[model samples]
Target: MNILPSYRYQMADHKKSILIFYVVIVGLSLIFGFSTTLIINGNDAAVHGSTSGNEMATVIFLFVVGLCTFKETFLISLQNGVSRKTLFTAKLLTMLSVAVIMAMIDKIFFLLYAAALSITNSQVTASTFYEALYPSSTAGAGPLMLHAESFFFEVLLALAAMAAGYFITIMFYRLSKTGKVIVGAGVPVLFLMAIPWADQYFLNGKITIALVKLILTAVNTPSHMAVTCLLAIVVFNALAFTLMRKAVVKQ
Candidate 1:
């Protein structure tokens, strides 16, 4: 069987869901943008509006979509007798394609927002999500380079999220009912209880400081952050595939 064609067909099945997601996002953006414009127009002094929330929304949407896609695709493909290897390849391709498309859409939306602000003669300033993510260095780069870097980072982040979602799904699928219960309930409870205990007892209330230092280190080293993210993506997907290879389809 030609796996490429089969994969394309399987991805096509998700067009409706993708379209709905896009529509919802666009609709909300319009509502918020217009409302903010109106509010600013009514004010006496010049006000600036920011669309920084768009990046967070995009990340969350991609993550949720990734989780749904992996779970649904795995079940359908398993029922249809698809090999684990083919399924993994298909999922990887689908996630990359989706990441590219979403990144382009985000850029387009930013342009549209900027144009609207200009046309309305609003004092509001708009920036691309990439600018928000890499505020300092992005401002120094040429437009093409800035966009290229943004696209690359978006693809890496999306792939990482997809891999994580797939790995989680596989873990659940491979667990027994009791194990699932333990994972679903016990894990969260442990995190809730253990975090404070560890911070107070083990770290002497310095966990927050350590976390801030780690974040600052990462922010200072973009290349290292990118490499770390890529490594995480590979590890997550590798674990997911390993689990899938040994997983039995649920009856």
Candidate 2:
């Protein structure tokens, strides 16, 4: 059984969902873009027009896509006579392709918004999710290179999220009811205990400072962070595949 055809088929199955997501993103972008343009045009003061919101929408899209794709596809593919290994490979390929395509669509929307602003003679400041997340000071690179870097970084993040979501779904599927209850109760309790303990003892009661430092580190060295994220994605996917190898399809 060829995996490419299976991957393509799976992707095609989700085309409608992808299209709806694209439409929602474009609609939101247009609303923000035009509203900012109109507001700035009406103002007497030299207020800078700013269009923000796409980043949040992009994140939501990636996260929801990641969360929904795995369990459904796993069961369906398994029932269709596909081997676990092939299904795993196909799912990985599908996630990568979707991530790349969505990233490109995100960049296109940014360009389109800029062009729309130009046409309306509006001096709006537009920034992508990547730019907002990882602002840099030194800039000798061309726009193309910067966009490419952003695209690559976003793709890695999307893949990592997808892998984590898939792993969670598989774990949920394989767990007993009592096991689920323990996990559901134990995780939040662990977090509640750990956060305060870390803040009080380890962080000198300055959780905010620790968080700020972490964000600054990530923003300052995005390339290194991207590599770290990719490594995490590989590890997550490996574990998910291992779990799935023993997963029995539910009737």
Candidate 3:
């Protein structure tokens, strides 16, 4: 089969979920602003505006999509005689396209949300996850540069998240039932229990502090974040392709 069809099919799968996601995010935000205004301003709740980092939700959503989209597609493609490389390539292209589209949509929403917020109640201010993290990094940049940085960060982070999800699905596909159960349980145990216990008792939180510092240093600027995310995306996809080569059609 043509790679274009696979690419389009993958994108099509994401389309409905994305629409519903935006509808819910925007709808909930509207309700929040209106109700908050109504309660505080005593019936003067006309189109009040607020802001938060909605892009985080998009990243998480794309990750879940990645985790869920693989099994059926992989099974169907192998049955239809599509090679693994073509499947991987199509998925890569689809993830990149989705990242770009979602990034654009996210930035557009942020601008519109900001504009709307400016016209409404000034009691609450606007901020973003990036701004909250690196408050001084882009404070002196031009409007175009600021937006470009934000767009790049959105694309890169979302892309990386999607790649990680795909890698996870491929890994799970390759694992046996018992292996799957062990991994599914072990990962949470490692993070939620072992790691915390080690960091707290054995390492005295040094590991946790070091990790926090590493993350902060790596993402101190948009360019830094871009590089970090690109590396992660590359590693995740490479591992995924390796896993896919060994993935078999399960009954």
Candidate 4:
């Protein structure tokens, strides 16, 4: 797989995509980090609390990195010569792995920033810092990693969302020229709408909210809210993938 044309194809496209992704990632990080530093340092707000800017950035970074990496994973799978089912499985696995790594990196970066700047309360030690950073879910498990429980549901949701996107792109690839325009514009608009709807309907309301909160927090944490978002993305991806698999490719 390492030297496969599929892998090479994926990597080649990612060169440009990764550059663009990095630019956005760095820009967002700087903007959020600076704003957080200013707010924490300037305000009389409790630094160690959940409302910290650093905390917000940590969550944002996880999501941004997860989605970004997932896109690359999907593109990479296209380069690997495989059946649609195989591609889907490989891409989903890669995306999940990326999400976990991104979460860890975001966590570490947030902690280091807090420690270096002394933005946290003096009472919060490094060991306690992690616990506070990743508070226990209502389920009683502290968090995914470093804990006995696995975030399997969360992982599944992330893969589902990514699969949905890959399928959507393939669907677009099969469209007539006019249909392509409709899809290009329509899909993103619907996606934008879905973001808030997922929050209002799934994340905060109904059995979905309780189910998630039971397993994770729906508050400010990424780990808390990501599974919900990923599920929404998954619903779209499943439909898209099904359609794409049936789609007629001209090439």
Collision count for each candidate, in order: 0, 0, 0, 3
Instruction: State every prediction's TM-score relative to the real structure.
Output: 0.90, 0.87, 0.88, 0.49
Candidate 4 on 1-251: residue-level lDDT in tens? 43344434433433564356446765775676566666666767666423232333333433444334433444445554455565555444555554454444445654565575556443222332334444554335444453322233334333544555555556666678999988888778765676557767766655455665666555355454565566665676576557646654354
When sorted by lDDT, best at the front, the candidate numbers are 3, 2, 1, 4
The better candidate by lDDT, 1 or 3, is 3
Each prediction's whole-model lDDT (CA): 0.76, 0.77, 0.83, 0.50
Model 2: residues with Cα > 4 Å off, grouped in runs: 52-56, 197-219
- Give stretches of model 4 more than 4 Å off: 1-81, 119-161, 181-237
lDDT of 4: 0.50
What is candidate 2's lDDT per residue for 116-198, written digit by digit as tens? 67787787877666766666632555788777877787788878877887787788788888998989788888768878787
Better by lDDT, candidate 3 or 2: 3
> Over 4 Å off in model 3, which ranges?
38-50
* Residue 172 lDDT, candidate 1, scale 0-100: 88
Of candidates 2 and 1, the better by lDDT = 2
Q: What is the lDDT of residue 20 in candidate 4?
A: 63
- True-vs-predicted CA distance for residue 31, candidate 1, Å: 1.0
Q: What is the lDDT of candidate 3?
A: 0.83
Worst-scoring 10-residue span by lDDT in model 2: 132-141
